[model samples]
Target: MTRTPRGEAPDVGVPAHLAEHMTVAEQHDWIAGFLRRHPVSRRSALRRGSGVVAAMGLASAPWTLAACASAASAPVSVVGRHLSFGDDPLRSMAMAGELTAPPQGRVVVDLGQNGSFGATLPVEVRRLVSQVPQADGSIRASDQYFVHALATGLQPGQGYDYRFRLADGTTTDTATFHTAPRQPTSPWSFTAFADQGVDMVPPSGLSGFTNAYYKPDDTRRTMTPSTSMVDRIAATRPAFHLLAGDICYADPSGEGEPVKSTGTSKSPSGFDSFDPTVWTTYFGLIERSAASTPWMFATGNHDMEALYDDNTARGALHGYGGHAARLDLPRTGPSACPSVYSMRYGNVGVISVDANDLSMEIPTNAGYSGGSQVAWLRQTLLQWRAAGSGIDFVVAFFHHCAYATSSTHASDAGVRAAVAPLFDEFSVDLALQGHNHQYERSNPIRAGRSTTQVPDGGTARPETDGTTYVCVGSGGRPRYSWQPGEVDRYRGNPAPQGDVNVVSYQAVGASAKVPDAVDWSQARYLDYAYVTVDVVPPPGPGQVTTMTLRTITDTGVEIDRVTLERRAR
Candidate 1:
């Protein structure tokens, strides 16, 4: 609540005179503390990177000053700082993010071994154009580009020092990253969630929808210091972060606009549509964690830009113009379905499938790549199961739920009809889903029956048979409820639900009903939570691998835990 004298740089949240005498590290820490305590509107000191870089003495080198200066007008809103090596077969990474203009010059990637630069990779840059409908019925156009530096041949389980070199021969600060392990000899964990909002400060006169479920009181209590779920995830320090979808909710209305009731269906309040600012806010929110971790993505329904109802008008685009521009998903799946891809880390093989291709809920891409995606899925699973495949478990994650019972957007019948059989046939160890806005897991199910009942904090051997389906949609969005009072995991008996879990009918009542005593429901929680899966490898290869799935609250509370064991066939 005080103003610094004009013409002199503000002390970056420290006493002005003391800041002048502080070390680079001290200044960096001071700036970080300032950002944490004060509103971002006071970030003019760090806005263009000049003041902050100077404050840290990082711009002392002439080349460094040149590189930082280029970004001043580069329109680089936020760097998609994370990698997705876990989702790419070659373990190559596409370092991409949203930008307002096409980037110039090549980027030099220095992969350091130990403390020295082991290899330098130079890649060309390219751009993807996006045209989105704005709130005022105008088109907001922008270009996003990848660094073109595809980092390959990285040794798994090895940590490397890396940095970037701009076109002007300027090098950036060194950052450290660890590659996913090819074989885990011990327990390894990764964080996962969906529906995380950017927490944007809306434009003047525009506000977000009031979330009825994740009330202000609950958010006030659970939100961390940065007021971000990413902060909590970073605290766990998982190998990677799996974003199940709806990364920013940069839709027409955003997170604050209330849903507009329109007949049987409802839409968001039309305040803004695909404004790049949403992504700007999103990248800033996760920069703390994503900059180092491989934050992989699975396309959710909201990620697409589908404003029209006519299916034919949408064409084969599937509403990923903006997404394709900003993010670089693996192109290993069917050419028609860029969202479908697979990768492996340790003994675990993960397949990110796009349900929009066959989704009855959002039919923009219905049947476009249905056959191809299925064929790819079968082949991918078969390859992972082949002799010497090294893969002990296969995890398939997508947006829609195949066996969720949340009060909103229950298990999609279309998903079950198309994808469920393949899961059983391939003996997938796990199926992760979102869109339900709650946390729920099913028993080890095969052919609509429970193959094994896994209690809370229990373990199951999915490698021998059956698959466990889990929903980790409660990342940061409003929580959904369960229809019944209490759906027991072991038995079909109805009991009173606990305080953490709520009961609501407006969302999943009619669609979530299961025939016969549906005892397949396992652990269920209705809160803003995420799932951390720990994949534990055996002492040696060709042995049993275990995956412990823990559903944790944003505030770091472990509510439910399930361990799954699998072995390579």
Candidate 2:
């Protein structure tokens, strides 16, 4: 079971006939062809081919009925439709402000202020186009819609009120955002989470794992879906929001099931094809928090859904074009994947990498970053640690966990073998990850193993300690159960198999090895939660900078909390 570029499990299971030498694209095509030639007929098989027509709202006319019937008889493209971020001018008219990197004179750059783009008065607003993949493997361009952003300039620790100008020249309600303090002495805070896109289907009465669609009522809301978990995060009013990936499950719908459309009537089955409007809905859900703070994103596997071609989506690593065009992110790393970049807020230097390039779990765009990215990461960390860099704490975040213990998705060996060593060498304070759908934290780890356990609410000095890796993937997705005997093992059980120190596999068959248990795993929780890191200043000069990290469930419960300190260089 080879991995994909996104560092998750391979999209499709192993084939009956091993095609070890085939490229991912070749394998993908071969599987599709095989499935077509030998179609698997099921109860809802009638709508398998023609679901796309009804999903696109083309089933309204009488003549379309004939077309739909004919389509239902043939093999239909099950790839779904999406709504445009700029579909409505009025909807797009809201602006969120973020501070620039250089501590400029009241300037607001893109997310994390990693780039330089001068802001002038009387900014011109124009319509933005969002691209969608069609059923026939073609690109469908949405109508252009515009949003006007007003930059009032900015000041350290200052709250600025702003409004968005609609395409028709109307203005949106005022929203306010606060800038981070200019110096490292000032304390700051931020939030991080991943995999919060809600795509549940209406339940069908059945039994077993394939029985019912897991659609919760809140997931189907028109606005501010509960699954978004943005409301609670907004209440904290963090300096920015770090989305590690799978922000929207806009990929194929039904979670590894065939596309089935119930009828042209009411709501489609919970297991319907993809819906592009999920993007529109997702943005609305996250608006409150994002509009108030910088919302930085790292592309996950789901974000790389280039239905027509790899580059169709936006951001680095063959990401979604629409997702990239919608946000104002820093363009510092390789131009091919702008999502990989660095930023500084107070004493924290945040570096985001594109794991899709090296991920064997999602091979759609494997080798996209090549070796240049890891080289860049090494250099970025070295620069931050240098004198006069003003970065006291180095935090790196991306999709795919380097060290995690969830039964649903284990640690990505590629990430651990390639990236973890660099992080340890650079004395990175914290490594944040998602895609496991659970919350797990590791002790300060060096050389692929933990030297000692960092207790909950404990403080670790990075200068002498290794890097701490945390998986905060429970941002509103269904929780993944832990490995067997995880509870007893995490509670200091000494048995080998029952120990929680291992990053087990979801891979099938033999030839898999159970490496020595990872003594670094200190905490594990199976709940829907997010992490908030508060950067606190040291009490004296030459002292360490401290960061308080807390994992809070959606219900406001603090599940796990820890503090990390980085001594002055």
Best by TM-score: 1
lDDT of 2 by residue, 386-487 (tens): 897877888888887788877755676666766888988888889899988777888888887786767777788777788889887877665667776575
User: In model 2, how many backbone clashes occur?
Assistant: 26
Q: Write the per-residue lDDT of candidate 1 for residues 1-569, one digit (tens) a residue.
A: 11111111111123334433433234344444543554332133123111111111112211111223435544332243555563443345544433222344556777776779978887555443323222222222333344545677766677777766655665655666787665667787888887776444322112323344345545423533223568877777888788877676654243323122121112334322333334544665675687677788888766654321112221225445445545666666777676788878777888888876655544434566748888888899889888888788888888877777775566666677778898888889888888887778888988866887677878888755589998888777666666666543312214543332233322112123333335577677666778889877877655666889887776666778888886544
Model 2 — which ten-residue stretch has the worst lDDT?
A: 202-211
Give the TM-scores of the predictions, in the order they appear. 0.74, 0.72
The global C-alpha lDDT for each of the candidates, from Candidate 1 onward, is 0.58, 0.55
Give model 2's TM-score versus the native structure: 0.72
Check candidate 1 and list the clashing pairs.
208-256, 208-257, 209-256, 209-257, 209-258, 407-507, 407-508
Please give the lDDT score for candidate 2.
Answer: 0.55
